[model samples]
Target: MKFDKDAWLLEAIRIKYIIPREDGTVWRRKWISADLKSMSREVHLIKQRTHKATQRVYFNLTFKGITKSVLVNRVIALAFLPNPLKLPQVNHIDGDKSHNYLKQPTPELVEKWGEYQLEWSTGRDNEKHAHANGLKTGRGSQNSNAKLTAPQVVEIRASAESPSAIAKQYGVARSTIVNILEGKTWIHV
Candidate 1:
């Protein structure tokens, strides 16, 4: 059976949201409870920071004496959105990683924006969304790290020349040429 993370989260954590103040900053308050009623403690938001590599906002939370770093987007999704399909990834519909609130839109907001900001998605859907939003540069020429253009990859694949000869001509590693010929990389092109 598939493990239900939301169900486990509901039993493990009770999250409470504080209304935004005049400055328009929403405050998220987490209440750790031993039982649903009596024993509880409030803790300040800890180590919340934008990840330098992915540029996604995240924070560390302690659960059962173990500290885990979790993305703020996933936390917001877990708190406010429903994932009936149990998709393994949460996509930021607008491609803004810092905008982590997964609240439903008001009628006025819907009329203006037309869609929710977050949704459950498969890994492929998430990748597609990122590429569609220009957040990800896909394989081949579109990728910043791509050494060869699509036409060059095609030429390399069609060439009967040795991998070393092709690599020297393209100024890339022999393994790169070999991989291209072997259909290991640049499969999209």
Candidate 2:
């Protein structure tokens, strides 16, 4: 199966931030279809590498006159995978964002790497999968910006102080205190 260019174009049109052309098409549609004959061709030629911040495999591809970073997994999924449910997010099953290919050591590679899997997933399911795989770190005391320790979380749970007072004492928001009190966060502890 081929990438559904029309579906992508229509989705792009739904974004309010995109500036529309005089012909009623958005900027994304104009450039995405301008010179690109097939997505597969562009995807194959581009050098695949991992983004440092995102850990996702991507490559820069020039469309019309604009060069943009294209995600390898999304391209491969759109081109080859079936998404009957039209799920919005693409998940790397093994928690390795750089692992996007379905087959090991594609024709482009001489050395064999194990097959990487991908699936169409909803936003919530994608997050659950990431947490399950330890890919995400924004939960509990593992969060880099977390102010409270596990002991503090326990103390907060046991405190009878008003939420505002507890928040003030801990230098955090009242909502944080409330969430802790209600057991909305810091679940593992």
For each candidate, the alpha-carbon lDDT, in order, equals 0.66, 0.63
Clashes of 2: 0
Give the runs in model 2 whose Cα sits over 4 Å from its true position.
Answer: 1-44, 103-116, 144-189
Model 1 CA RMSD to the hidden true structure, in angstroms: 6.6
Q: What TM-score would each prediction reach against the true structure?
A: 0.58, 0.51
In candidate 1, position 155 carries an lDDT of 89
lDDT of 2 at 39: 28
Candidate 2: lDDT of 148? 94
- Distance from true location, Cα of 64 in model 2, Å: 3.8
lDDT, residue 12, model 1: 44
Residue 38 displacement in candidate 1 (angstroms):
4.0
* Model 2 worst lDDT window (10 residues): 22-31
